[model samples]
Target: MNYSPELVQFLGSLVAILAVAGLAWWMKLGGAPELSNEKEAQAAASEAMDGFESVETAVDANGRGAILRDRSGCLLLLKQHGNKFAGRLLTHSATGRIDKDKLVVDSGERRFGVVALAIDHAQSWADRINEVRSASDA
Candidate 1:
């Protein structure tokens, strides 16, 4: 069997191209679901605190605070101060727990999977007030 140099070079180049393309696809170089997920989170945040206005946005050495507020009182403060998630329901100090693959925030009085996001960083008891205001407003 006689083999040509040009044919061997073409095969080698084809293999290299395929390997590079596979790696690019695996790494998601062209922006995939990861980017969409971030946009989705932002949308969720907005939906969670619908009536609130962004009063202040701060990100210092300590952490980040995207403070939002409503007409009557403060709403949920999305804080990134050394926490697991980007933002959590910031009404109480108690940690979030899981119940049958669901998240529950135990604030002593109530324990629920979904709590309406209320005012952010307006007052000390802003979260409590927000819940009340939201109920009344609705």
Candidate 2:
């Protein structure tokens, strides 16, 4: 069999491209295991709230963030940032809304920015957090 140098180089480039594409597909960046149950949610919550001693309660569905309640009954929004997770405590004045599949929570003037949760049950999370906020007010 006879092969031209140009053809060999082209084949090599194609193979490299395919390999890279395959690796990216397999990696599933920003993808996490489904948090269908309390146990899985707790695990994600724990990872998000790294310094927290324990996660008393948590709500999550296969995605970016989780609503966590610590041992002190403090509500926190746990979100992924790069290789690690960060958390923002939900204060009494905290407010939230569901825009599409995202739960946007603003911890009033004290907190610097908004915490957006991209999850399956974004509305449910907003509702739950609002319910907690109302209950706390009462």
Candidate 3:
């Protein structure tokens, strides 16, 4: 069977597109997984900073982010990035505040930007994180 140049080119493009789509699906890079519970958040925080034992954690209501405190009073902020969660240990250069019922945390990394988590008693968490900032400043 004979085919025109245009038809062959179109078929090749379609095949290439399909291959890329299939590869993405196989690699599981399509969506970000939610941080559903404190265990998951704690794990992510530990991965971000080794020896980070979560004494307390507040999971975001929308499952987009989390904030955790270690035994030494250190706070670890977890934010969703791609399919996994990226974390920053809140010490120096970190700030937190409550906007309405949500706790907004800034890691001060600029690129990492800000993360807002809706948790119970957001202000308390915010104050705890600010304490981390204060202690580092002194």
Which model scores highest in lDDT?
Answer: 3
Instruction: Sort the candidates on lDDT, descending order.
Output: 3, 2, 1
lDDT of 2 at 47: 64
Off by over 4 Å in 3: 1-28
Worst 10 residues of 1 by lDDT: 56-65
1-138, model 1: which lDDT tens digit per residue? 877999999999999999998998898776422112333344434655654343433221222233333444443434332222234434434333344432333333333223222222323333353454456567
Q: Candidates ranked by TM-score, best first?
A: 3, 2, 1
Model 2 stretches with alpha carbons more than 4 Å out: 1-44, 47-63, 69-74, 109-112
Q: What is the TM-score of each candidate against the true structure?
A: 0.26, 0.48, 0.76
lDDT of 2 by residue, 2-81 (tens): 99999999999999999997897789755444445656556666565566554554444445556766677667776555
**Global lDDT of each model?**
0.41, 0.67, 0.87
Residue pairs that clash (backbone atoms under 3 angstroms), model 3: none
lDDT of 3 by residue, 58-137 (tens): 99988888998888787888899887889988767888887877899999899999999999989998888888778778
Lowest lDDT 10-residue stretch of candidate 3? 83-92
Best by TM-score: 3
